[model samples]
Target: MVVKPDWLRVKAPQWERVGNVKDILRDLGLNTVCEEASCPNIGECFNAGTATFLIMGPACTRACPYCDIDFEKKPQALDPTEPSRLAEAVRRMKLNHVVITSVNRDDLADGGASQFVRCIEETRAVSPHTTIEVLIPDLCGNWEALEIILRSQPEVLNHNTETVPRLYRRTRPQGNYDRTLELLKRCREFAPWVYTKSGIMAGLGETDAEIRQVMQDLRGVDCDILTIGQYLQPSQKHLQVNDFVTPEQFAAWQAFGEEIGFLQVVSSPLTRSSYHAEQVRELMKLYPRQRV
Candidate 1:
Protein backbone atom coordinates (compact mmCIF):
# COMPACT_ATOMS: atom_id res chain seq x y z
CA MET A 1 0.00 0.00 0.00
CA VAL A 2 1.32 3.46 -0.83
CA VAL A 3 1.34 5.91 2.03
CA LYS A 4 -0.27 9.24 1.32
CA PRO A 5 2.00 12.26 1.51
CA ASP A 6 1.59 15.08 4.05
CA TRP A 7 0.84 17.58 1.31
CA LEU A 8 -2.24 15.59 0.33
CA ARG A 9 -3.93 15.94 3.70
CA VAL A 10 -7.24 17.76 3.62
CA LYS A 11 -8.19 20.30 6.24
CA ALA A 12 -11.28 19.48 8.30
CA PRO A 13 -14.29 21.42 7.12
CA GLN A 14 -17.07 23.02 9.17
CA TRP A 15 -19.68 20.32 9.81
CA GLU A 16 -22.62 22.69 10.18
CA ARG A 17 -22.39 23.99 6.64
CA VAL A 18 -21.63 20.55 5.26
CA GLY A 19 -24.64 19.10 7.04
CA ASN A 20 -26.93 21.81 5.68
CA VAL A 21 -25.84 21.10 2.13
CA LYS A 22 -26.27 17.37 2.64
CA ASP A 23 -29.76 17.90 4.00
CA ILE A 24 -30.81 19.82 0.89
CA LEU A 25 -29.44 17.16 -1.43
CA ARG A 26 -31.15 14.44 0.56
CA ASP A 27 -34.41 16.38 0.68
CA LEU A 28 -34.34 16.86 -3.05
CA GLY A 29 -33.03 13.31 -3.62
CA LEU A 30 -30.22 14.67 -5.82
CA ASN A 31 -26.91 12.92 -6.30
CA THR A 32 -23.60 14.76 -6.16
CA VAL A 33 -20.33 13.52 -7.68
CA CYS A 34 -18.73 14.64 -4.43
CA GLU A 35 -20.47 11.78 -2.61
CA GLU A 36 -20.78 9.26 -5.43
CA ALA A 37 -17.14 9.55 -6.55
CA SER A 38 -15.70 9.75 -3.00
CA CYS A 39 -14.01 13.02 -3.79
CA PRO A 40 -11.28 14.02 -1.30
CA ASN A 41 -12.63 17.58 -1.08
CA ILE A 42 -16.28 16.68 -0.43
CA GLY A 43 -16.38 18.18 3.04
CA GLU A 44 -14.79 21.41 1.90
CA CYS A 45 -17.03 21.76 -1.17
CA PHE A 46 -20.21 20.93 0.69
CA ASN A 47 -19.27 23.29 3.50
CA ALA A 48 -18.86 25.95 0.86
CA GLY A 49 -22.40 25.11 -0.41
CA THR A 50 -21.12 23.92 -3.80
CA ALA A 51 -21.64 20.54 -5.42
CA THR A 52 -21.28 19.02 -8.87
CA PHE A 53 -24.77 17.72 -9.43
CA LEU A 54 -24.72 14.19 -10.84
CA ILE A 55 -27.83 14.01 -12.96
CA MET A 56 -29.42 10.86 -14.47
CA GLY A 57 -27.49 8.79 -12.01
CA PRO A 58 -26.11 7.48 -9.05
CA ALA A 59 -25.52 4.36 -11.28
CA CYS A 60 -23.14 4.50 -14.20
CA THR A 61 -23.45 2.34 -17.28
CA ARG A 62 -19.73 1.92 -17.82
CA ALA A 63 -17.54 0.42 -15.09
CA CYS A 64 -14.35 2.43 -15.18
CA PRO A 65 -11.91 0.75 -12.81
CA TYR A 66 -10.56 3.94 -11.22
CA CYS A 67 -13.93 5.53 -10.50
CA ASP A 68 -15.88 4.91 -7.28
CA ILE A 69 -19.37 5.61 -8.64
CA ASP A 70 -21.54 2.49 -8.75
CA PHE A 71 -21.85 0.46 -11.95
CA GLU A 72 -23.16 -2.83 -10.58
CA LYS A 73 -26.66 -1.54 -10.07
CA LYS A 74 -28.90 -1.14 -13.11
CA PRO A 75 -29.37 2.43 -14.25
CA GLN A 76 -32.81 3.79 -13.53
CA ALA A 77 -35.09 5.59 -15.96
CA LEU A 78 -34.64 9.35 -16.08
CA ASP A 79 -36.90 11.17 -13.64
CA PRO A 80 -39.07 13.88 -15.18
CA THR A 81 -39.00 15.88 -11.97
CA GLU A 82 -35.21 15.86 -11.56
CA PRO A 83 -34.55 19.05 -13.49
CA SER A 84 -37.01 21.15 -11.50
CA ARG A 85 -35.76 19.65 -8.25
CA LEU A 86 -32.14 20.43 -9.17
CA ALA A 87 -33.14 23.94 -10.12
CA GLU A 88 -34.90 24.23 -6.77
CA ALA A 89 -31.70 23.19 -5.02
CA VAL A 90 -29.86 25.92 -6.88
CA ARG A 91 -32.47 28.48 -5.87
CA ARG A 92 -32.46 27.41 -2.22
CA MET A 93 -28.69 27.25 -1.98
CA LYS A 94 -28.37 30.60 -3.75
CA LEU A 95 -25.31 29.40 -5.60
CA ASN A 96 -23.50 31.82 -7.91
CA HIS A 97 -22.56 28.89 -10.20
CA VAL A 98 -23.59 25.26 -10.64
CA VAL A 99 -22.02 22.22 -12.37
CA ILE A 100 -24.28 19.51 -13.72
CA THR A 101 -22.53 16.27 -14.75
CA SER A 102 -23.64 12.69 -15.27
CA VAL A 103 -22.76 9.05 -15.34
CA ASN A 104 -22.42 7.42 -18.77
CA ARG A 105 -25.85 6.45 -20.00
CA ASP A 106 -24.86 4.46 -23.05
CA ASP A 107 -28.09 2.48 -22.98
CA LEU A 108 -29.90 5.57 -24.16
CA ALA A 109 -29.64 6.50 -27.81
CA ASP A 110 -28.53 10.04 -27.07
CA GLY A 111 -26.34 9.07 -24.11
CA GLY A 112 -28.48 11.21 -21.81
CA ALA A 113 -27.80 14.43 -23.69
CA SER A 114 -31.49 15.32 -23.57
CA GLN A 115 -31.41 15.06 -19.81
CA PHE A 116 -28.50 17.52 -19.71
CA VAL A 117 -30.43 19.94 -21.88
CA ARG A 118 -33.45 19.65 -19.61
CA CYS A 119 -31.30 20.30 -16.58
CA ILE A 120 -29.83 23.37 -18.24
CA GLU A 121 -33.23 24.72 -19.26
CA GLU A 122 -34.72 24.08 -15.84
CA THR A 123 -31.73 25.61 -14.10
CA ARG A 124 -32.06 28.66 -16.29
CA ALA A 125 -35.74 28.93 -15.54
CA VAL A 126 -35.23 28.94 -11.76
CA SER A 127 -31.81 30.50 -11.30
CA PRO A 128 -31.20 32.65 -14.34
CA HIS A 129 -28.26 34.41 -12.75
CA THR A 130 -26.40 31.29 -11.70
CA THR A 131 -23.81 30.55 -14.38
CA ILE A 132 -23.96 26.86 -15.36
CA GLU A 133 -21.27 24.40 -16.41
CA VAL A 134 -21.83 20.89 -17.69
CA LEU A 135 -19.09 18.27 -17.25
CA ILE A 136 -20.19 15.61 -19.73
CA PRO A 137 -19.16 12.25 -21.04
CA ASP A 138 -17.99 11.79 -24.66
CA LEU A 139 -21.43 10.49 -25.68
CA CYS A 140 -19.91 7.57 -27.58
CA GLY A 141 -18.88 9.90 -30.41
CA ASN A 142 -22.46 10.74 -31.20
CA TRP A 143 -22.07 14.22 -32.66
CA GLU A 144 -25.84 14.70 -32.92
CA ALA A 145 -26.21 14.07 -29.21
CA LEU A 146 -23.34 16.49 -28.68
CA GLU A 147 -25.25 19.07 -30.66
CA ILE A 148 -28.29 18.76 -28.39
CA ILE A 149 -26.30 19.75 -25.31
CA LEU A 150 -24.23 22.37 -27.13
CA ARG A 151 -27.35 24.19 -28.25
CA SER A 152 -28.24 24.96 -24.62
CA GLN A 153 -24.93 26.82 -24.24
CA PRO A 154 -23.80 26.11 -20.69
CA GLU A 155 -21.23 28.74 -19.65
CA VAL A 156 -18.59 26.00 -19.66
CA LEU A 157 -18.44 22.55 -21.30
CA ASN A 158 -16.03 20.10 -19.60
CA HIS A 159 -15.14 16.55 -20.61
CA ASN A 160 -12.17 14.97 -18.89
CA THR A 161 -9.56 13.10 -20.94
CA GLU A 162 -8.87 11.27 -17.63
CA THR A 163 -5.46 9.98 -18.71
CA VAL A 164 -3.00 9.79 -21.59
CA PRO A 165 -3.67 7.78 -24.73
CA ARG A 166 -1.19 5.05 -23.83
CA LEU A 167 -3.06 4.30 -20.59
CA TYR A 168 -6.55 4.42 -22.08
CA ARG A 169 -6.72 0.64 -22.50
CA ARG A 170 -5.76 0.12 -18.87
CA THR A 171 -7.44 3.10 -17.23
CA ARG A 172 -10.36 4.01 -19.47
CA PRO A 173 -11.02 0.98 -21.65
CA GLN A 174 -14.34 2.27 -22.93
CA GLY A 175 -13.02 5.78 -23.67
CA ASN A 176 -11.16 6.88 -26.76
CA TYR A 177 -8.48 9.59 -26.75
CA ASP A 178 -9.29 10.74 -30.27
CA ARG A 179 -12.99 10.76 -29.47
CA THR A 180 -12.39 12.81 -26.35
CA LEU A 181 -10.42 15.39 -28.32
CA GLU A 182 -13.06 15.46 -31.02
CA LEU A 183 -15.74 16.12 -28.44
CA LEU A 184 -13.86 19.13 -27.11
CA LYS A 185 -13.07 20.33 -30.61
CA ARG A 186 -16.69 19.93 -31.64
CA CYS A 187 -17.88 21.75 -28.56
CA ARG A 188 -15.57 24.62 -29.41
CA GLU A 189 -16.68 24.71 -33.02
CA PHE A 190 -20.37 24.27 -32.29
CA ALA A 191 -20.53 26.62 -29.36
CA PRO A 192 -17.68 29.06 -29.67
CA TRP A 193 -19.15 31.20 -26.93
CA VAL A 194 -19.26 28.37 -24.40
CA TYR A 195 -15.87 27.85 -22.78
CA THR A 196 -14.48 24.35 -23.38
CA LYS A 197 -12.62 22.58 -20.55
CA SER A 198 -10.88 19.24 -19.97
CA GLY A 199 -9.23 17.57 -16.94
CA ILE A 200 -6.38 15.06 -16.57
CA MET A 201 -5.51 12.82 -13.62
CA ALA A 202 -1.90 12.46 -12.56
CA GLY A 203 -0.22 9.63 -10.55
CA LEU A 204 -1.50 7.15 -13.11
CA GLY A 205 1.98 5.90 -14.00
CA GLU A 206 2.09 8.57 -16.66
CA THR A 207 5.40 10.34 -17.16
CA ASP A 208 5.65 14.11 -17.08
CA ALA A 209 6.10 14.09 -20.86
CA GLU A 210 2.84 12.13 -21.29
CA ILE A 211 0.98 14.62 -19.11
CA ARG A 212 2.33 17.53 -21.11
CA GLN A 213 1.31 15.85 -24.36
CA VAL A 214 -2.25 15.50 -23.11
CA MET A 215 -2.25 19.16 -22.12
CA GLN A 216 -0.98 20.06 -25.56
CA ASP A 217 -3.69 17.94 -27.19
CA LEU A 218 -6.32 19.75 -25.12
CA ARG A 219 -4.91 23.12 -26.12
CA GLY A 220 -4.93 22.06 -29.75
CA VAL A 221 -8.69 21.77 -29.42
CA ASP A 222 -8.85 25.26 -27.96
CA CYS A 223 -9.98 24.00 -24.58
CA ASP A 224 -10.22 27.13 -22.44
CA ILE A 225 -9.75 25.56 -19.00
CA LEU A 226 -7.59 22.67 -17.80
CA THR A 227 -7.48 20.91 -14.42
CA ILE A 228 -4.78 18.46 -13.40
CA GLY A 229 -4.95 16.55 -10.12
CA GLN A 230 -3.34 13.59 -8.40
CA TYR A 231 -5.34 10.38 -8.72
CA LEU A 232 -5.95 8.50 -5.48
CA GLN A 233 -7.13 4.88 -5.43
CA PRO A 234 -10.81 4.63 -4.60
CA SER A 235 -10.53 1.11 -3.17
CA GLN A 236 -8.36 -1.97 -3.05
CA LYS A 237 -10.17 -3.32 -6.12
CA HIS A 238 -9.43 -0.15 -8.07
CA LEU A 239 -6.17 0.87 -9.73
CA GLN A 240 -3.32 1.43 -7.32
CA VAL A 241 -1.76 4.84 -7.05
CA ASN A 242 1.38 5.11 -9.15
CA ASP A 243 2.76 8.18 -7.36
CA PHE A 244 1.71 11.17 -5.33
CA VAL A 245 2.37 14.23 -7.46
CA THR A 246 3.80 17.11 -5.45
CA PRO A 247 2.61 20.71 -5.26
CA GLU A 248 5.80 21.83 -6.98
CA GLN A 249 5.07 19.55 -9.96
CA PHE A 250 1.48 20.70 -10.10
CA ALA A 251 2.75 24.31 -10.13
CA ALA A 252 4.96 23.46 -13.08
CA TRP A 253 2.03 22.03 -15.04
CA GLN A 254 -0.08 25.10 -14.23
CA ALA A 255 2.71 27.38 -15.40
CA PHE A 256 3.20 25.41 -18.61
CA GLY A 257 -0.52 25.46 -19.29
CA GLU A 258 -0.68 29.23 -18.88
CA GLU A 259 2.35 29.67 -21.12
CA ILE A 260 0.65 27.52 -23.75
CA GLY A 261 -2.56 29.63 -23.67
CA PHE A 262 -5.04 27.88 -21.39
CA LEU A 263 -7.32 30.65 -20.14
CA GLN A 264 -7.33 29.08 -16.67
CA VAL A 265 -5.45 26.11 -15.24
CA VAL A 266 -6.09 24.61 -11.81
CA SER A 267 -3.51 21.97 -10.86
CA SER A 268 -2.82 20.52 -7.44
CA PRO A 269 -3.01 17.34 -5.40
CA LEU A 270 -6.70 17.80 -4.61
CA THR A 271 -8.02 19.61 -7.66
CA ARG A 272 -11.08 17.78 -8.98
CA SER A 273 -12.83 18.84 -12.19
CA SER A 274 -15.39 20.91 -10.36
CA TYR A 275 -13.21 21.91 -7.47
CA HIS A 276 -13.52 25.67 -7.05
CA ALA A 277 -15.19 25.73 -10.51
CA GLU A 278 -17.10 28.84 -9.59
CA GLN A 279 -13.92 30.81 -10.24
CA VAL A 280 -14.87 30.66 -13.91
CA ARG A 281 -17.38 33.42 -13.19
CA GLU A 282 -14.45 35.74 -12.65
CA LEU A 283 -12.68 34.33 -15.72
CA MET A 284 -15.77 35.23 -17.70
CA LYS A 285 -15.31 38.81 -16.58
CA LEU A 286 -11.59 38.88 -17.39
CA TYR A 287 -11.86 37.22 -20.81
CA PRO A 288 -15.45 37.80 -21.64
CA ARG A 289 -16.71 35.86 -24.70
CA GLN A 290 -19.90 36.60 -26.48
CA ARG A 291 -22.78 34.27 -25.62
CA VAL A 292 -24.40 33.22 -28.85
Candidate 2:
Protein backbone atom coordinates (compact mmCIF):
# COMPACT_ATOMS: atom_id res chain seq x y z
CA MET A 1 0.00 0.00 0.00
CA VAL A 2 1.20 3.49 -0.78
CA VAL A 3 1.80 5.81 2.18
CA LYS A 4 -1.11 8.10 2.97
CA PRO A 5 -0.08 11.62 2.05
CA ASP A 6 -0.36 14.71 4.28
CA TRP A 7 -2.92 16.27 1.96
CA LEU A 8 -5.20 13.35 2.71
CA ARG A 9 -5.18 14.24 6.38
CA VAL A 10 -8.20 16.01 7.89
CA LYS A 11 -8.74 17.98 11.05
CA ALA A 12 -10.10 16.06 14.00
CA PRO A 13 -13.89 15.85 14.09
CA GLN A 14 -15.97 18.40 15.95
CA TRP A 15 -17.37 15.93 18.43
CA GLU A 16 -20.17 18.21 19.65
CA ARG A 17 -21.80 18.40 16.24
CA VAL A 18 -20.93 14.80 15.40
CA GLY A 19 -22.45 13.72 18.68
CA ASN A 20 -25.63 15.61 17.91
CA VAL A 21 -25.93 14.01 14.47
CA LYS A 22 -25.20 10.61 15.93
CA ASP A 23 -27.85 11.09 18.58
CA ILE A 24 -30.47 11.74 15.90
CA LEU A 25 -29.47 8.71 13.85
CA ARG A 26 -29.10 6.51 16.86
CA ASP A 27 -32.34 7.68 18.35
CA LEU A 28 -34.12 6.97 15.09
CA GLY A 29 -32.21 3.76 14.40
CA LEU A 30 -31.15 5.10 11.02
CA ASN A 31 -27.94 4.28 9.17
CA THR A 32 -25.60 6.46 7.18
CA VAL A 33 -22.99 5.61 4.51
CA CYS A 34 -20.68 8.14 6.09
CA GLU A 35 -20.37 5.87 9.13
CA GLU A 36 -20.78 2.52 7.36
CA ALA A 37 -18.29 3.14 4.54
CA SER A 38 -15.80 4.95 6.80
CA CYS A 39 -15.80 7.95 4.48
CA PRO A 40 -12.85 10.27 5.18
CA ASN A 41 -15.13 13.31 5.11
CA ILE A 42 -17.54 12.04 7.74
CA GLY A 43 -16.41 14.55 10.38
CA GLU A 44 -16.79 17.51 8.06
CA CYS A 45 -20.14 16.34 6.75
CA PHE A 46 -21.56 15.44 10.13
CA ASN A 47 -20.18 18.55 11.77
CA ALA A 48 -21.91 20.62 9.15
CA GLY A 49 -25.20 18.91 10.14
CA THR A 50 -25.32 17.00 6.86
CA ALA A 51 -25.02 13.30 6.23
CA THR A 52 -25.86 10.73 3.53
CA PHE A 53 -28.31 8.25 4.99
CA LEU A 54 -27.68 4.59 4.24
CA ILE A 55 -30.82 2.52 4.26
CA MET A 56 -31.18 -1.28 3.99
CA GLY A 57 -28.59 -3.31 5.81
CA PRO A 58 -25.00 -2.51 6.55
CA ALA A 59 -24.19 -5.62 4.51
CA CYS A 60 -24.31 -5.60 0.71
CA THR A 61 -25.16 -8.38 -1.72
CA ARG A 62 -22.29 -7.48 -4.02
CA ALA A 63 -18.94 -7.71 -2.20
CA CYS A 64 -16.94 -5.32 -4.29
CA PRO A 65 -13.28 -5.74 -3.34
CA TYR A 66 -12.52 -2.05 -3.05
CA CYS A 67 -15.54 -1.23 -0.91
CA ASP A 68 -15.62 -1.19 2.87
CA ILE A 69 -19.26 -2.30 3.22
CA ASP A 70 -19.60 -5.82 4.56
CA PHE A 71 -20.76 -8.76 2.43
CA GLU A 72 -23.35 -11.15 3.76
CA LYS A 73 -24.53 -14.51 2.47
CA LYS A 74 -28.15 -13.71 3.29
CA PRO A 75 -29.37 -10.54 4.93
CA GLN A 76 -32.34 -10.02 7.24
CA ALA A 77 -35.80 -9.02 6.10
CA LEU A 78 -36.21 -5.39 5.00
CA ASP A 79 -37.35 -3.11 7.80
CA PRO A 80 -40.69 -1.70 6.76
CA THR A 81 -40.53 0.97 9.48
CA GLU A 82 -37.17 2.34 8.34
CA PRO A 83 -38.69 4.91 6.03
CA SER A 84 -40.61 6.66 8.75
CA ARG A 85 -37.65 6.58 11.06
CA LEU A 86 -35.46 8.11 8.35
CA ALA A 87 -38.02 10.81 7.71
CA GLU A 88 -38.10 11.68 11.36
CA ALA A 89 -34.34 12.02 11.32
CA VAL A 90 -34.52 14.49 8.46
CA ARG A 91 -37.16 16.45 10.31
CA ARG A 92 -35.08 16.61 13.45
CA MET A 93 -31.90 17.47 11.60
CA LYS A 94 -33.70 20.21 9.71
CA LEU A 95 -31.91 19.43 6.47
CA ASN A 96 -33.04 21.22 3.32
CA HIS A 97 -31.46 18.64 1.01
CA VAL A 98 -31.07 15.01 2.01
CA VAL A 99 -29.36 12.06 0.33
CA ILE A 100 -30.53 8.48 0.82
CA THR A 101 -28.53 5.47 -0.41
CA SER A 102 -28.73 1.77 0.25
CA VAL A 103 -26.79 -1.43 0.21
CA ASN A 104 -27.55 -3.71 -2.73
CA ARG A 105 -30.49 -5.80 -1.64
CA ASP A 106 -30.38 -8.36 -4.43
CA ASP A 107 -32.23 -10.73 -2.12
CA LEU A 108 -35.51 -8.97 -2.91
CA ALA A 109 -37.33 -9.38 -6.21
CA ASP A 110 -37.42 -5.64 -6.89
CA GLY A 111 -33.96 -5.13 -5.41
CA GLY A 112 -35.56 -3.12 -2.61
CA ALA A 113 -36.97 -0.47 -4.93
CA SER A 114 -40.25 -0.42 -3.03
CA GLN A 115 -38.40 0.37 0.18
CA PHE A 116 -36.77 3.33 -1.57
CA VAL A 117 -40.15 4.54 -2.78
CA ARG A 118 -41.59 4.33 0.71
CA CYS A 119 -38.62 6.26 2.06
CA ILE A 120 -39.18 9.00 -0.48
CA GLU A 121 -42.88 9.19 0.25
CA GLU A 122 -42.39 9.16 3.99
CA THR A 123 -39.67 11.79 3.88
CA ARG A 124 -41.72 14.00 1.65
CA ALA A 125 -44.70 13.55 3.90
CA VAL A 126 -42.72 14.51 6.97
CA SER A 127 -40.47 17.15 5.47
CA PRO A 128 -42.07 18.28 2.26
CA HIS A 129 -39.60 21.10 1.84
CA THR A 130 -36.55 18.83 1.68
CA THR A 131 -35.04 17.94 -1.67
CA ILE A 132 -34.10 14.27 -2.00
CA GLU A 133 -31.22 12.63 -3.84
CA VAL A 134 -30.74 8.88 -4.16
CA LEU A 135 -27.49 7.04 -4.84
CA ILE A 136 -28.56 3.57 -5.85
CA PRO A 137 -27.32 0.22 -7.03
CA ASP A 138 -27.95 -1.18 -10.52
CA LEU A 139 -30.78 -3.37 -9.17
CA CYS A 140 -28.98 -6.31 -10.77
CA GLY A 141 -29.83 -4.88 -14.24
CA ASN A 142 -33.56 -4.89 -13.60
CA TRP A 143 -34.69 -1.83 -15.51
CA GLU A 144 -38.13 -2.24 -13.99
CA ALA A 145 -36.66 -1.83 -10.54
CA LEU A 146 -34.72 1.21 -11.73
CA GLU A 147 -37.93 2.74 -13.05
CA ILE A 148 -39.65 2.27 -9.72
CA ILE A 149 -37.03 4.42 -7.99
CA LEU A 150 -36.99 6.99 -10.81
CA ARG A 151 -40.74 7.40 -10.48
CA SER A 152 -40.20 8.75 -6.98
CA GLN A 153 -38.57 11.80 -8.63
CA PRO A 154 -35.49 12.56 -6.59
CA GLU A 155 -33.81 15.88 -7.33
CA VAL A 156 -30.65 13.97 -8.29
CA LEU A 157 -30.28 10.32 -9.24
CA ASN A 158 -26.65 9.36 -8.53
CA HIS A 159 -25.13 6.01 -9.47
CA ASN A 160 -21.42 5.59 -9.21
CA THR A 161 -19.31 3.97 -11.91
CA GLU A 162 -16.75 3.45 -9.13
CA THR A 163 -13.73 2.67 -11.28
CA VAL A 164 -12.52 2.22 -14.86
CA PRO A 165 -13.76 -0.62 -17.09
CA ARG A 166 -10.50 -2.56 -17.01
CA LEU A 167 -10.68 -2.84 -13.22
CA TYR A 168 -14.36 -3.75 -13.19
CA ARG A 169 -13.75 -7.47 -13.13
CA ARG A 170 -11.30 -7.38 -10.23
CA THR A 171 -12.57 -4.40 -8.23
CA ARG A 172 -16.29 -4.79 -8.88
CA PRO A 173 -16.77 -8.38 -10.03
CA GLN A 174 -20.56 -8.40 -9.95
CA GLY A 175 -20.73 -5.01 -11.73
CA ASN A 176 -20.73 -4.69 -15.52
CA TYR A 177 -19.37 -1.52 -17.10
CA ASP A 178 -21.83 -1.68 -20.00
CA ARG A 179 -24.70 -2.31 -17.62
CA THR A 180 -23.68 0.70 -15.54
CA LEU A 181 -23.67 2.93 -18.62
CA GLU A 182 -26.99 1.50 -19.78
CA LEU A 183 -28.58 2.22 -16.39
CA LEU A 184 -27.65 5.91 -16.67
CA LYS A 185 -28.91 5.98 -20.27
CA ARG A 186 -32.24 4.51 -19.21
CA CYS A 187 -32.60 7.09 -16.44
CA ARG A 188 -32.38 9.83 -19.08
CA GLU A 189 -34.94 8.08 -21.26
CA PHE A 190 -37.30 7.20 -18.43
CA ALA A 191 -37.02 10.45 -16.49
CA PRO A 192 -35.60 13.21 -18.61
CA TRP A 193 -36.74 15.79 -16.06
CA VAL A 194 -34.50 14.39 -13.32
CA TYR A 195 -30.84 15.35 -13.15
CA THR A 196 -28.68 12.23 -13.62
CA LYS A 197 -25.35 12.21 -11.78
CA SER A 198 -22.48 9.69 -11.68
CA GLY A 199 -19.19 9.40 -9.78
CA ILE A 200 -15.82 7.62 -10.24
CA MET A 201 -12.81 6.89 -8.00
CA ALA A 202 -9.24 7.15 -9.24
CA GLY A 203 -5.83 5.65 -8.14
CA LEU A 204 -6.91 2.10 -8.89
CA GLY A 205 -4.47 1.63 -11.76
CA GLU A 206 -6.49 3.29 -14.55
CA THR A 207 -4.87 5.61 -17.08
CA ASP A 208 -5.93 9.21 -17.63
CA ALA A 209 -7.07 8.26 -21.14
CA GLU A 210 -9.38 5.62 -19.69
CA ILE A 211 -10.74 8.13 -17.19
CA ARG A 212 -11.45 10.65 -19.97
CA GLN A 213 -13.15 7.94 -22.00
CA VAL A 214 -15.40 7.20 -19.07
CA MET A 215 -16.21 10.90 -18.85
CA GLN A 216 -17.06 10.92 -22.56
CA ASP A 217 -19.26 7.87 -22.14
CA LEU A 218 -21.14 9.51 -19.27
CA ARG A 219 -21.65 12.63 -21.38
CA GLY A 220 -22.90 10.43 -24.25
CA VAL A 221 -25.69 9.32 -21.93
CA ASP A 222 -26.37 12.98 -21.09
CA CYS A 223 -25.26 12.59 -17.48
CA ASP A 224 -25.58 16.08 -16.01
CA ILE A 225 -23.21 15.93 -13.02
CA LEU A 226 -19.82 14.22 -12.56
CA THR A 227 -17.69 13.66 -9.45
CA ILE A 228 -14.20 12.22 -9.29
CA GLY A 229 -12.36 11.26 -6.09
CA GLN A 230 -9.23 9.38 -5.16
CA TYR A 231 -9.87 5.86 -3.85
CA LEU A 232 -8.40 5.02 -0.47
CA GLN A 233 -7.95 1.42 0.60
CA PRO A 234 -10.04 0.66 3.67
CA SER A 235 -8.07 -2.22 5.12
CA GLN A 236 -5.31 -4.73 4.50
CA LYS A 237 -7.89 -7.32 3.43
CA HIS A 238 -9.20 -4.98 0.72
CA LEU A 239 -7.68 -4.08 -2.63
CA GLN A 240 -4.28 -2.37 -2.36
CA VAL A 241 -3.80 1.22 -3.47
CA ASN A 242 -2.11 1.65 -6.85
CA ASP A 243 -1.49 5.40 -6.76
CA PHE A 244 -2.42 8.70 -5.14
CA VAL A 245 -3.72 11.00 -7.85
CA THR A 246 -2.58 14.61 -7.46
CA PRO A 247 -4.88 17.54 -6.76
CA GLU A 248 -3.61 19.28 -9.88
CA GLN A 249 -4.66 16.30 -11.98
CA PHE A 250 -8.06 16.29 -10.33
CA ALA A 251 -8.52 20.00 -11.13
CA ALA A 252 -7.51 19.34 -14.75
CA TRP A 253 -10.12 16.56 -14.98
CA GLN A 254 -12.77 18.88 -13.52
CA ALA A 255 -11.88 21.47 -16.16
CA PHE A 256 -12.01 18.84 -18.90
CA GLY A 257 -15.37 17.53 -17.70
CA GLU A 258 -16.86 21.04 -17.62
CA GLU A 259 -15.46 21.76 -21.06
CA ILE A 260 -17.33 18.73 -22.41
CA GLY A 261 -20.72 20.17 -21.28
CA PHE A 262 -21.23 18.74 -17.79
CA LEU A 263 -23.36 21.21 -15.88
CA GLN A 264 -21.44 20.57 -12.65
CA VAL A 265 -18.23 18.70 -11.98
CA VAL A 266 -16.80 18.12 -8.46
CA SER A 267 -13.32 16.67 -8.93
CA SER A 268 -10.62 16.63 -6.28
CA PRO A 269 -8.59 14.24 -4.16
CA LEU A 270 -11.06 14.47 -1.27
CA THR A 271 -14.23 14.82 -3.34
CA ARG A 272 -16.85 12.12 -2.69
CA SER A 273 -20.23 11.55 -4.26
CA SER A 274 -22.06 13.62 -1.65
CA TYR A 275 -19.32 16.10 -0.83
CA HIS A 276 -20.80 19.60 -0.65
CA ALA A 277 -23.99 18.16 -2.09
CA GLU A 278 -26.02 21.12 -0.84
CA GLN A 279 -24.34 23.05 -3.64
CA VAL A 280 -26.19 20.89 -6.17
CA ARG A 281 -29.30 22.93 -5.41
CA GLU A 282 -27.74 25.59 -7.64
CA LEU A 283 -28.48 23.35 -10.63
CA MET A 284 -32.15 23.64 -9.84
CA LYS A 285 -31.83 27.43 -10.06
CA LEU A 286 -29.81 27.24 -13.32
CA TYR A 287 -32.24 24.83 -15.00
CA PRO A 288 -35.44 24.72 -13.03
CA ARG A 289 -37.06 21.30 -13.08
CA GLN A 290 -39.42 21.06 -16.04
CA ARG A 291 -42.28 18.66 -16.45
CA VAL A 292 -41.63 16.10 -19.10
Q: Pick the TM-score winner.
A: 1
Judged by lDDT, which candidate is best?
1
Cα deviation at 248, candidate 2, in Å, is: 0.3
Per-residue lDDT tens digits for candidate 2, residues 54-84, read: 9888888888988888895467799989999
Taking all chains together, each candidate's TM-score versus the true structure is 0.99, 0.98
Taking all chains together, the TM-score of candidate 1 against the true structure is 0.99
lDDT by residue for model 1 over 30-75, one digit each (tens)?
9999999999999999989999999999999998999999999999
Residue 191 miss distance in model 2 (angstroms) = 0.7
Off by over 4 Å in 2: none
Clashing pairs in 2: none
